[model samples]
Target: MTLVFSTCCFSPFPPLHPGRLTVLPQEALVQIGGSIQLNCSLDCPDGTPQWKGLDTNLGNIISTPTYSLLLITNATVAMEGTKFCVGNCQGKSHQGSTNLQVYSLPDTLQLETQPKELVAGQPAHLHCSISKVYPPGSLTLSWYRGDQRLESPDAEEVADDEELFSYDSELEVPGEKVTEGMEFRCEVELLLPPSDRSFHRATAVTVSTKGKSWRSELGILARWVCNFSCQSHFPMSLAILVCQG
Candidate 1:
């Protein structure tokens, strides 16, 4: 019995584990006016988390373990870059980052042009074509006369496929209006949700009557040619000649 009395001691301690930080919108390419959200979460039970955008050098730490950083109401090209989130647990630090890409909207947008040079007091049609849009979303089309916006009764929107969206407008120029050398514009806008930013594309054509007579003559000649031409040939091949003429 005396030999068996050896003392046994035990020590109790919790296992150590590493902390983790996560960011959302992991891979994104957004328009200048669009926005995004970065959510930061930590695995550690006892830690304060902070979020920072490395490009802007802006950040904040909150008492709550989880934190969210908003891209705000609108974003610009200057805001493009990597954003970081950090979690500190008892002096131990863990960090994560997400890359952001911002693109510039087109300055002019248009698909088809009838009577390329618009004439006053005449009906004109402009087709707006928006193509190669990333992150498929809803779109809006608008027409402008100089700086003033125009209302169209025959404006129609059509999505040709997943990568293309278009709108056509039949505009009636006021009979008494004189729009010499004035600019007529077409604008296309793409909308994204959870963000205040909109992608924009626009195209402008100069108004002139100098070429109207020539354009009409060309149209008459085109009609005559088409009337006699064989329909068996590819429509695109003939279209190219008409467009070039």
Candidate 2:
């Protein structure tokens, strides 16, 4: 009688790791009509990576086992949105995302004096306008006189003639600060996330009347010399002496 035994060993499956997906340039900032690119990576050596958001068709999309890339060209405000990077490994999925923000600086910034003339003790107006702006809430208008900063006023919505937005605001001129020739500067700032852009524009308004012009007074003096030979030792009459000119 003979006994025979057979044994076989099987290896367990490796752990599943979708891996951590990383998106380069966590956030993107692009101006209108410009373009941007985002890089993506899945740490796992065997993971499949892909870009899942934005206008993927705008540019080339490179997908490899180690990394993926998304390119956006001729970008517009409409293209601004959340972009995602997705990866899969061992039937599990992992992902990460970034925000694409698109903005435009004011097309035309203008500062003007309403009346184009200012007078001490008289109220005048300073006007600031920002045209062709995007992301409505980003526009801000500020006023300044010389080296001093003035208060900010509520911005008024100007009628939009095109697809973009326009904003304007007026500040009452400081009668006390008004001078014969002085410039008032208006600064327009577009407060975008991660940055702030500024544009300085100023307009000078001359005072209609120079200061102290009304209260100015003048006085005249006349000097007269009369040649008179006093008679030797002659006493001149008091009234005649006083009248001599």
Candidate 3:
């Protein structure tokens, strides 16, 4: 007859909580035509989660609680904005969002050749030209020979008021003591402020030496003449040869 007394002995169960999404690399500012990966994770393992892109219907549902959305190929300005992830856990739903920023970079870069190919004991000139750059900054040009930087007498820089810059460098080929058919490289760098997010372009050339000896040629000619004279017997040995003084 005391059934009401049993209700006072039972404890109430706790309410279910919703799932959450955590993203690594919280903020991203990347250049266009680059790649990025957004790692997302859910705290609970109840149901499959889905990812949605802002202003687009590109949605993907994954079985695992943790997933990575990769901009595997290339990124553009159009790819910037908020991305979202929605999931359900313990009969409750949650969502998370992230913002992306995209930037543009320089386009054209080339090396102007002054003796594009060089030999030892020779002088060479190299110049780098950059086109289509924004927010002009200081430019640095360097000459490298097989991973080792070469010293130059003049490191000249020229810039236009409209955000274009160029650098010219003159280098002398090292003597035989340091020559080994090495590779030479010319590099151009655009210096950015505060963060040093510089962009670099480079070109390389091969260095070699010109043949400077006639001894090898004379030896081959002598061998051919001796072989011909031995085969012919028409008084070839009777002819007298004299050397000039």
Q: Quick one: best TM-score, which candidate?
A: 2
Across 49-108, the per-residue lDDT of candidate 3 in tens digits comes to: 666644443223234654535342366545667777676677777677666655443654
Candidate 1: residue 188 Cα off by (Å)? 1.5
Tens digits of per-residue lDDT, candidate 1, 1-245, equal 35664446533666565676777777656664665666677767766566654533332333465554645336554565777778887678888887666544345555565666567655566666554443434556777878898885544655544433345555545535436677777777766544546767777777676766777899888766665555645485686587468
Model 3 segments more than 4 A misplaced: 1-11, 15-19, 24-74, 78-112, 128-141, 151-180, 187-203, 213-245
lDDT of each: 0.62, 0.69, 0.58
lDDT of 2 by residue, 137-241 (tens): 777777777667888767876545444677787888656767656666776777776545443344434456644564342111111111232434334554245
For model 2 the local lDDT of residue 94 reads 88
Using alpha carbons, what is the TM-score of model 1?
0.43
TM per candidate comes to 0.43, 0.65, 0.43
Stretch of 10 with least lDDT, candidate 2: 218-227
**The candidate that achieves the highest lDDT relative to the unseen native structure:** 2
Q: Which residue pairs does candidate 3 place in steric collision?
A: none
TM-score of the candidate numbered 3? 0.43
The C-alpha local distance difference test score for the whole of candidate 3 amounts to 0.58
